[model samples]
Target chain A: MTGQDFPEPGPFATLSGAEVDLGRLRLRLVAEAERESLLDVVYRTVDAPVGRLLLAATRRGLVRVAYEVEGHDTVLATLAERISPRILKAGGRLDTVAGQLDDYFSRARSGFEVDLDLRLASRFRLTVLEHLREIPYGSTASYAAVAALAGSPRAVRAVGTACATNPLPIVVPCHRVVRSDGGIGRYVGGDDAKRALLRLEGAI
Target chain B: MGREPFEVVVERYGPMVLRVCWAVVGPTLAEDAWSETFLAALRAYPQLAPDSNVEAWLVTIARNKAIDQLRAQSRRPAPTERLPESIRWEEPDAGLDLWDALRRLPRKQRETVAYHYLAGLPYPEVARLLGGNPASARRAGADGIASLRNMLAPSAREKGPR
Candidate 1:
C-alpha cells in the first residue's frame, strides 16, 4: 500500500479519544475498589439538617468538611490541587466518621472523637482551630477570645481569617466562635448552619 | 525527591493503557484489564522509581492484566450454544470496529502494532514488551498495519476522509 493509504494522522487518533473516555468510566469502578488502599484522599457526602456535607479524609484523619454552599466540586478540585491529587469518592474509609456525624447531627453526640488531619491548615490557622475545639459543646466564644486562647490577643481579625478558612468546620466546632457583639458571625457552613448546630447543642 | 500526585499519572497514561488493553484483549474484557492495571499501578505508584518511563510501566501492567483475563477465560468451561451478551461488541461507535480487525492479527503482530501504533511506544520498547529485538518488532508492526490497511481500505474510501 502507498504511504497515502495510511491516511494522514489516520483512524487511530480518533479511536484513542473514544477509548480514553471509555477508560475513564472504567477507571471509576477501579477507583472505587482501590480507594481505601490507593487514593490519597477519600471523600463521601452525607445529608444533614444544614445541607449536604462533603467529608474528605487523608490516611492521617478527616481533612475537610465542606457545606453544599461551598460547591463540592470546587472544594474537591482545590483539595486535588493543594493536597494530593489521588482523590476518589468512596465512603468505606469514612464509616466511623459518617456514624459520628450522624450522631452529632441527630443531637445524640456532644463531641467528636475522630482524629483530625489538620495539615491543610497553616500554623496560625491551626492554632485558631485548636482553640475552636475548646469553645465547649453548648457555648460560644468571641473571635477575640479565640485569638487570646490561640496566644495572640491582638490577632482577632486573624482569628476570623482562620475561622473563614477552617478546613474541618463542623467537626472542629468553628460554629461556636461568634462575634463579640452577641451577633452570630459568618460560618464556613453559613450562619444558618452555625445556628442549626448551636440550637442542636441547646446553646441557642 | 517529591512525587507527583497519582492523579497526574492516571490522567496521562490512562488512554494509552486502555488502547493497549483493547488491542490485546479486544472489547469484551478490555475495560476490565484496563481497570485492574490502573488499580495495581496506583497501589505501587509511590514506590516507583522517579526516572521510570511511566507510560511503558502502565502498558506492561495492562499487558499482564489482559493475559490474566485471557488465562481465566481459557480455564472457564466451554459455553453452551447460546453466547453471552457481554461477549458481543455492541458497536458503540464506528471506530470501535477497529477491535475486530485487530483480533484478526497474529498475537505478536497484534502486540507489536498495539505497543507501537496505538500506545505510540518506540520499536525498542515494544520489542522489550513482546520479548524480541527492535528490528523484528518493527517488521511485525509494519506487517500488521499493512494488513489492516488492506482490510480497512474500502471502508475508509466509503467513509470519505473522517
Candidate 2:
C-alpha cells in the first residue's frame, strides 16, 4: 500500500506531495543566484520588426541577438556550449536592451545606449563592428566604405563577412552596411529584413 | 559537451529538494534551506562530475544545509509547543495530517527517515550522518515510517468504503 508502514524499513511520512509554489520558489532562487554572481547568463526573447529576437547577456552586458530564422534554441545551446552552462532565461539584465530595441524599431531612437559584450567577435570583426556603429542612422554605407573606415581599405569582402556574422545584429547596426552599388547586401536577417531596417531608419 | 545547463538541473530536481527540505526543517525555513542548497550547488556545478548522480549529490548538500539551518535555529528563541493546533502547514486535509504527525517523531528518527527514504541514502550512510551505527539507523527509520503509517493509513482505508 502506498501509505502503509514500511515493514522493510521504507519512509511513509512523504505520502502526500508537498504543497509548493514552484514558480515563486524559482523566483526566489533566481534572485539569490543573481545576487551571488552565480547566474552567468540571462536571456530573453523580444518581438521586433525583424521577427522574434533572442537576446542573451552576461553581467558584462548585451552579447548575442538571434533572428527567428537562426533558430532560437540552437542559439541558446551554442551559448551554453561556448559560454558557461550556467545560463538561465531571465529578463533582469535584458530589460534595458529590449526597451532600446523597441524604440529603435519604432524610429524613436537613433542610437542604442546599452553596454555591449563583443566577446563573440574576433579582432578584425570587432574593428568592423566599431565602424558599422559609426555608419549613423537614416543612412547607408558601402562595405568598401566600412572596410576603409575600419582601417582595412582592401578588406571589403572581410567587412561583408563581419556584417553577416555580427553577433549583436540590430544593436551593432550591421544592417546599414550595404553593397557599394547600393544593392542590398546579404544579411543575417535576410535581404527583406535588411531592406525593412533601412526603411525603418528612413534611409531607403 | 554532455553537461546539462544548470537551469535544467534546477528544474529537474528543485521540487524534490524543496520537499525534503520542508520535511527536515518545516515550512518556515524550508525555502531558506532550498535557496542555500541550490546556490551552493550552482557555485560548485562546474566541477561536478558529468557522470555523477546529481539527485543524490544535491540531497547530500541539502542535508548539510538543512543541518546548518537547524543549528542556527537552535540558537534562536525556542518555539514553545504548537498548542491549539490552529497553525497547520498542510491545511484542509480531512485525513491524517503528515506534518503534524512528523513533528512528533524524535529528531534522530525524523532525520533517519528523511535521509534513508527521501534522499535515497543507504542505511549505513544514513547512520554515518547521524553518528550512529547501521542497525540503529535502520530501527529509527522503521520507527518513523511505522508511526506515520499507523497515524495516517487507517484513515485512508476507512474513507475508501464510504
Best candidate, lDDT-wise?
2
The local lDDT score (0 to 100) that residue A88 gets in candidate 1 is 61
To one decimal place, how large is model 2's interface RMSD in Å?
5.4
Candidate 2 global TM-score = 0.79
Q: Candidates' lDDT values, in order?
A: 0.77, 0.79
Candidate 1's C-alpha runs over 4 A off are A1-37, B1-19, B26-32, B43-101, B112-162
Candidate 1 per-residue lDDT, tens place, B39-153, comes to 8887776677778888888888888999998788679874432211222233465355576567778989988788877777788888898887988987898788887776567
What 10-residue stretch in candidate 2 chain A is worst by lDDT? A1-10
Worst window of 10 by summed lDDT in candidate 1 chain A? A1-10
Query: Residue A45 lDDT in model 1?
Result: 95
lDDT of 2 at B64: 91
Please give the distance, in angstroms, between residue B139's alpha carbon in candidate 2 and its true position after superposition.
7.3
Candidate 2 residue spans exceeding 4 A from truth: A1-19, A181-183, B78-96, B106-144, B154-162
Model 1: which docking level applies?
incorrect
Who wins the TM-score comparison?
Answer: 2
